[model samples]
Target: MSCSSSGNEAFMPDDIKEKIHNHPCYSEGAHHHYARIHVAVAPACNIQCNYCNRKYDCSNESRPGVTSERLSPEEAAKKVLLVGGEVQRMSVLGIAGPGDALANPGKTFETFGLVRQFAPDLKLCLSTNGLELATYIDEMVEHNIDHITVTINSVDESGEIGSQIYPWIFYNNKRIYGKEAAQILLERQLEGMKKCVEKGILIKANSVLIPGINDKHLPEVSKKLKEIGVFLHNIMPILSEPEFGTRFALDGVPSATDQQQMEVQEACGMDMKLMQHCRQCRADAVGLIGEDRGAEFTKDTFAGLSFDELQIKYDLEARQAAQAKIEEFRFFLDQANERVRKEKEELSSDGHTILVAVTTAGEGMINQHFGSVREFLIYEAGDKGIRFIHHRKVEAEYCAGPDGTNPLQPILDRLKDIKLILTAKIGGCPQGDLAAAGIVADQSYAYQPIEASVLKATRKYFNLPEEMEVN
Candidate 1:
């Protein structure tokens, strides 16, 4: 199933060409130019690899399963958009997690769906432990995820070698250990790889060159993967550090030297296409290989920020004087409504125009946490005055874990073409997000009537003309 250079025209499929053309991890030719970003949306693992310690994020260390932050599906999608804009060369959005992506299927697929909806051209990639490979292959294909990487350390004739590499595996709702666990994992991984191959999914097999453990057996592993139709093989060197804290911490396992890695890669290259440029990136890695920009988007850098700080970041002065004058605000609302009514009449004479969104509790009061609000009261803002359009439903209370995945994407999608958003309060990240979409998020009035907030926003923020101008 391996496509040699000589037989490239004969065996390489169209899907394979398109997938590898822009994917840096699979194509040596594209690595130097095109960029990729991996969003750590999945944080739950189903298998335990002895060499992997997913606890810390070390910048100096380059390996899979290490990330500075874990974002929710919506959060991941937002970051993907932000990063794509920031890095115009980015062509792929991958879900290579701090944990197994398949184990956290809900978040993984949700992130994929949101990103695909927004970025249809962006290539989607996923890396997994292969425990739940078969279970999710159909779904992955359905989502158009063409690139998948499976870490297969050992496929020894006996399960002894694999047993040393992986301490245990969680399968069938239970934990299996020792040789039996190794056998099950290997069988499943191979079966899953074969399934992915049959589905026309480009498979990249990653084998850890764990010196004494699986280094010698890698040729056999590579041969099996090639025979099973793996498109590429990546042999990664294990980082054996006691401070990293894993089962292999004090095992005295010597790290594979540069000479050892090259030699092993050469031997495996004969059987299959060897990926020599594997940087062993972290789960939340961004930008080009070896050029990590994750620090710019970390939770500490962007999360837990107040709107005041955000206003200062954008250099927007506090509207303290305007806010204090309740009478002026109320007057603006009245004039805004009258102007809106006239505008709507003109718009309805022809067609319709703009939409506005507001976060509020029932009975028309501006209340509810920006992160917790599950519904938005949408309105059609025109010269006819702001009229209630409908209620837009979203995921309720998305504040989960340190990296909270809000239903912001879906909410934004629902309130499409919205000119402004009136809310009691909003975080700095979301405020910036709204601003990017040309939607103003005004948190100037809290516990105020919804109509007053909407009217004030229309006249002052949205630049809607007053009734006097209409006259």
Candidate 2:
């Protein structure tokens, strides 16, 4: 907890805040997952994504406006009640379907209101293409709904957006279909972001990583977003399914490679996240209450009651009357826990005990980040499966203050039975101390996710294994 001495800025709480604010790791804060629910409220969209087939789990393959089961606002509320507590973080309702969310303002705002009433503490979020953002800005702020994601493809509009590639705009309360329309929409998009920031709304920019079309536009996009004080940028690759991944897409719209994504992030001087577990839930997806979809963590999250199954066969209570479904879900959880346990044994478990490996930086500075400085976790493993803890970043004190005895002491005072300490580097005093405490110190960086340079000196740690050890 104590971050003092040396590169004092490391000790400064504010700097870490800045790092996390721009980084995806902070979005989840202390937890490994940011649970989000996407509600197919409008079941519609104003604009179309060339790579989007409007489907659930559609990397252009999933179908949008899945019609069999739609929930009214009240029904959606009941679904939240069932899922809210299961996650450490909660995002209520994303309108993801066939039309612009704001175009169906009544259904959209009413659904949001229902969620706010039921789960007031939940982090409310929504994603749209920005065609209708300006009109509903007041309503969004009124509902206290921020955490908004606007998907922008291109600022450059050439023609009527004719065919699969056309730029259209919604101006003066009309859908003007033309290249100029895209230009106008782009203007509105920028204006909309400014308005949200002015109103203290936290904005996240979602750029579908198109290969040849807008790939070059990322630097410019990053500049504009940063100027607007955007919190984070998720340059989501154009998801591709075997069937349509190539067909309707641009001449070269394959999913952007990890390298390309990293390149853009570095170029933009923005923290661009690869979004490892991004499920791209339907507009009405009910993900783990507070877990990240990017981590592939959908289990108990439900859009409707479990009893209702696909959708509500009856009212929520009526459907939930069958407690068997809940019991069944619990059973599945137990099974999954076991499977993960077995996997860890071969991969991470040294014996009957699961070896929770944590890598640290040498200067012993990784601990500073654990002191409530973030909202999300770097590692997305389920908490029930393993017991892992770290005081990774030892906060350094800025302003020429004394190191003043490490703040890590309090956090360290807590670990009941820590087993091993994995690090690429560590200094003498810290190494001697950890060794004295019974933690086996070792060097590793095979598949670590933390920045390597930082891991070497400051001691960054990552533990995702390359292959599961099979028994």
Best by lDDT: 1
* TM agreement with the true structure for every prediction: 0.62, 0.55
State residue 322's C-alpha deviation in candidate 1, in Å.
43
How well does candidate 1 score on lDDT at residue 108? 95
Q: How well does candidate 2 score on lDDT at residue 70? A: 56
The residue-by-residue lDDT of candidate 2 on 295-390, one tens digit each, is: 232323453244334223222343333333433543443343333321222322334332233442211113222222211112212212232212
The most accurate candidate by TM-score is: 1
Would you list the C-alpha lDDT of every candidate in the order shown?
Answer: 0.71, 0.47
In terms of TM-score, how similar is model 1 to the real structure? 0.62
Each candidate: RMSD = 22.7, 16.8
lDDT, candidate 2, at 326:
38
